[model samples]
Target: MYAYQCIYLADVYLCEAGKLLVVPMDGSHWFTMRSVVEKLIERGHELVVVMPEVSWQLGQSLNCTVKSYKTSYTLEDIDRAMKDFAGTHWTVRDDNMVSLWMGSGYNFFELVFSHCRSLFNDKKLVEYLKESSFDAVFVEPFDMCGLIVAKYLSLPSVVFTRAVFCHYLREATQCPNPLSYVPLNFVSSSDVMTFKERVWNHITHFQERLFCHHFFKSVLDFASEVFPEPVTLYDLFSHTSIWLIRTDFVFDYPKPVMPNMVYVGGINCHGGKPLSKATKPGSRTQHGYDPLT
Candidate 1:
């Protein structure tokens, strides 16, 4: 077994001269940017963050430049899109919640088209990159559009995956796609959700597999149309110069590793900031909330 123990996102805030573009998939995980950009500044690099308008507060707090973009769909929007598409077989509970087949809390078709749209949305992101002239693009895994943009620009790209090795990265590295390799029964997270959440996510995982099989071919076609040389999704991901996994190697199973992929450890390592006595969960009376929140 390949065992990696210390998994933390370092908060050194290195500063380099070259511009680095950082984007996240979710608003809650915005701390990754805080830690990374701080490190970049400390090392002397210019830092910029791209995210949805919802995170404007985080942008203000960091005192960094931010470019807001549409990164997600609301639950209402998802329902509307599903209804618009034909040939989709969906089962919603009486409460209207869907099953999360893979425990990521996405519907099967949602996973597929969500990625497909991300792949297609590179044109917009490419324009931004050209305008900004960023040296590197570090993206959260959920921001698949960043991957597409990075590939288009041929810029050095780094993806921060919250989970262990996922299918896309596995395939890119010429390793067996983890989706195909791992048993369907496997649970990647420590806690399980209610049945309502499971029902929706399970269906989503199934849809994702079907979409990858069906829509990826068209993505290849589009790539050929856009580039002088033909490229596939696998080619795009393979072109990624660095893979930043948010995990340690220890708990993961043994597999053939690649040279470009680096185990950057976890997102929790922010150098050494001693947790205050009041910072503990139940000790609210001491520190009055670390204020980082």
Candidate 2:
């Protein structure tokens, strides 16, 4: 395989009017990615977004070719899942590590598996995608279907995400995130941790390592049918060309970065807006940018 360039998810320089295929995750994740899609459109990039018909935030007023596919899930299933997910923030209880560690994880996985299975079942779409001759794929890690598609098409996959789940980032990118200093996500500890916190970090990290395969089992089963060779999420991810993380140093602690990983964090953040009478003073500063004098 030819070496891939480290680039932004949106602004990859290509032949004029380069074609891009997008496989986006639903809900708030789409909100972050939509700005990138619009900017690409503004730059005259032809984009085709393939998404399930039953989605909360997709199918909006974006000027792109949106190809919808049927899924086993319905709108109500999505809403109910979202409702339960959001409802967790308000309903308080004792800290159950098992419950808190995997809040809404199974629900999200179930939906993703359903979509992945249905997407492949639509044999025509799969065949069309193979024939599209697209340049690259933009995908978030939460949805495994996009990765599967990239593998199927032999296209270079660009991952646009905050972080891969369960510390798969380390395995996939070969980037070192030391257990002692780099606190595992979901544990919520900073780079520096107390002895007890460090111990808890190890515990949490170990659990995810053990259970990660279980989380990915359903989708991997679909992958087995599609490919002659055995595959796993790790195999799909190891082929990623660019990793466009949605965080900057302002939002994330300093850590070791790999060559192919780019932090286009706050790339979605808009630039300065003119201050009017309605604009509160220093509001821009509060939002991480200084307002002009």
The CA lDDT of each predicted structure is: 0.55, 0.78
Residue 181 accuracy (lDDT) in model 1:
31
- Top TM-score model: 2
Please list the Cα RMSD from the true structure of every candidate, rounded to 1 decimal place: 10.2, 5.6
Q: Candidate 1: TM-score?
A: 0.56
Q: What TM-score does candidate 2 get on C-alpha atoms?
A: 0.83
Per-model TM-score versus the true fold: 0.56, 0.83
Q: Residue 157 error for model 2, in Å?
A: 0.9
lDDT of 1 by residue, 1-293 (tens): 01112234585543326778765554445566467667666656666776554332356555567665453565465445444442232443322222323222334234333543543465675476578877788776543556665676767787766552234566687765333233222344222445655554465456555645443454465556657898766777776777776667765655557876777676666566664576455655565444455
The local distance difference test score of model 1 is: 0.55
